[model samples]
Target: MREIELSLNQTQKIRLKRALEKLESLSSKANSNSNASVSISDSIPVNLEDGVLKGHGTLDLNGELVATVCGVVERVNKLVYVRALRARYKPEVGDIVVGRVSEVAQKRWRLDIHYSQDAVLMLSSMNLPDGIQRRRTALDELNMRSIFEENDVICAEVRGIQHDGLHLQARSQKYGKLERGQLLTVPPYLVRRRKQHFHHLEQYGVDLILGCNGFIWVGEHVEVKDDMVEDQVSKPEQQKSNKNSISLEEQEQTYTPIETRQNICRIANAVRVLSILGFNINIEVIMDTMNLSSSLNLDIHEMLGSEFCVLVAEGEAERRSLTKRKG
Candidate 1:
């Protein structure tokens, strides 16, 4: 039993991923019993292929297959209930899900997460980390949305469930605005059902929230920089000694990485063309608009780069109709 839980090596990891993928598909739709007239048992019968029904059972909590119902197996036992197969990482007591502030509600922020409405991140529920005894002032008149601004991305905890939607709390420094960097979303199904961990980019040094609803955000760890304080000192000699540090920070600026800038520019240009033309801008349009990549036949390689701007401004004036219409 102990060995069963041992870590899987890389090859084993891939194999397991493949196996889980198959299991996911197979478990989605159970096969019907061989004989049609028998009605295939009322529920999922657990008949193994070419094997006898070991007995009617349920796959129980402790991960052992156990019996829930009693009946004669017409064929192999394949009937099943409780479709909680791939329990990879469902939301639980204190999971931090990354979500964008969708809309400002009366007292809460409605986030457009793929979860079961916009999950509510209640203001009062936020971290008074030193606990209830840390109440410094009158807390009754606290407004919810004031703490969090509109469209601000927040990392929040799955405080609990109130209604069908998830309840959230963001009292800690861990749960706050995501700034500077960008976010990326993977398929919720892929993320939730990953038997293996979703690969993380170590270089980015960012916080990630894998929401049960499939929303993911990766960005610089705001409000937590270890070297930030050391970067500044009042003494001239100390400041002179850290000239390299200043240059390092400056080096980090001046230009975004090449590929990142390229992608950003390309996406911006695509949006520009799309909005300006008010039409479908194909590969041709993207290339032409960006002015970085070629529009010629073999330019497909340059078409895709991930630097997409979160927000782009609308134009001031419509391209004055260059129309001299003659049929």
Candidate 2:
């Protein structure tokens, strides 16, 4: 278990220890049924007559298959691989990821997605702000920085891995530059791949994007508006207003509400607590934790305190126990 450094009193320390032990017990019971944890150089039993195929994190030595990494062993048909509990993000096709722009090149932007190699977002792969499909010209290449400058945080889908490296695309309106959000990085393993990674908390007017690369974005919700409709509506208004004067709409876009900001912080802190506890992070779990904080009238910053961590640990243990019983 990873040690968490926090200030706590004697009573709080005792309570935290007990809660963590209970959580550990529950996790062990759950893992025992589904996975076999292995260490480095551990031999993986296999039937020679069946012809075993070793996959990633495995090495064949002296006609024996041994794990090359510390993780859980998984077998699929004749293929076997070890799933590392803590590792850098591994990109897969169609996975949603949030990454920061490392460099703005001629026709592509390089992004750091916590992977061994930086991912590439080509100009032809993404839709223009005007939502038009046309050939990218030299001018487009020249004005690339205007679209996405260096250090911009963007959300995109993994296109594929080619001879060069991993490529990403942002063809949809929902997948684009992210702004006014707190980006929180957690262990990629803690965030399992799911069907829906983008969530809008309507009640709080906040957007929660669980990036498969362990980049969690908590920001004020921005409605995906139709660019064509907006263009038609704004053309006449633009003619009426002075070109030098900023419009009310532009001002509104630049500002975020205080309540929304608070909610974003609250959600971000909940994710932090879950990451610190080494718990599986999902929308359901995050919402439950946020709701618990709200119910207890805990401040957003207080969620990081030792007392709240213990409470979360205990709650998680109970939740898992109930889930096991139901299963």
Candidate 3:
């Protein structure tokens, strides 16, 4: 049977997710009549021939535009085409995507962004040897992973969309690379379509890499590998093989005290108050403008700056709103 696919926006996707959850929650509240009688009017509005009336059998709807189908849905290409609203996206070229820095090659990185296959980055895509005439490295063998490093969150532009994956290129000096911090992954069903700048974060390190195939990895930073070792472990390869095993101490993460957090917040709040007066947000810009001491204000701004920077790095403005929400 012929079928149709429903395309929805980010708002529609979030709405559907919430609606589905609500239905599951209210399952126990179903009301039953003492003498249940089958009524054609109450039954799902099913029609095999002509199209069913728009929104025939809606159970729970937050907004009028969103509704569930009360009839049969056909499956094509393994996708069930229901008479319900759905979120979708269209692929295009030159779209900037914030994907997890997956496998880093000699000159490229593979992004695990829930696509058919991994995306690739080629050498000569960055501004490293910028404004110069010749290539930066004389050695053609310089590895890409070493330059960008593995799992270093990065922002790149989609050069082309392929059946397998995306052909990506890094943007300018401003729009590449990320540090260790928290991230969020929204369900692919909730995302509407491909966006231009998708690494939106809200005054935090919540970088997002929305994928079309519905796979996203939310991580602050890829934990650096355990390359650090005891004195003996760094010995030559042959010498290490000749020696016995070495004991490595586990490193405990140092936690920031609550007092420290409060102090930072106090200064940040003060800055926010001043920001209401039309001051810019950059740490240097605001600090110099306000003549606030960096010893105090700079630290707080640095903390908040990381969060705000991620919001500006995103592919879409609407998607950034998701990051702006409080915990």
lDDT of 2: 0.84
User: What TM-score would you give candidate 3 relative to the actual structure?
Assistant: 0.37
lDDT of each: 0.42, 0.84, 0.40
- Per-residue alpha-carbon lDDT of model 1 for 1-327, expressed as tens digits? 001232446655555445434433332323332321111223443334434334333433343334444322233334433322222335666665677888766556777555655788754666433334343344422434444557777666778877657788766544555554455443343343332222222333333344444455433333332233321111111122345667766857734465544354344444343332223223333333444333322242333322111111111111111111220
Instruction: Give candidate 1's whole-model lDDT.
Output: 0.42
Distance from true location, Cα of 277 in model 3, Å: 36
* Candidate number achieving the greatest TM-score relative to the actual structure: 2
lDDT of candidate 2 over 1-327, digit per residue (tens): 557777889998898788789877877777777767888999887775688788999998898889999988898989999998887888899998999999998689999998899999999998786667999999889878767888878898999999989999987777888888899999899899998888878899888889999998888777676553210100111121244587888878769888889999999999999998888899999999999999999998999998898888788878888897898
RMSD to native, candidate 2 = 4.3
- If scored against the real structure, what TM-score would every candidate get? 0.42, 0.89, 0.37
Score residue 166 of candidate 3 by CA lDDT: 70
**Predictions: Cα RMSD each:** 18.8, 4.3, 17.5
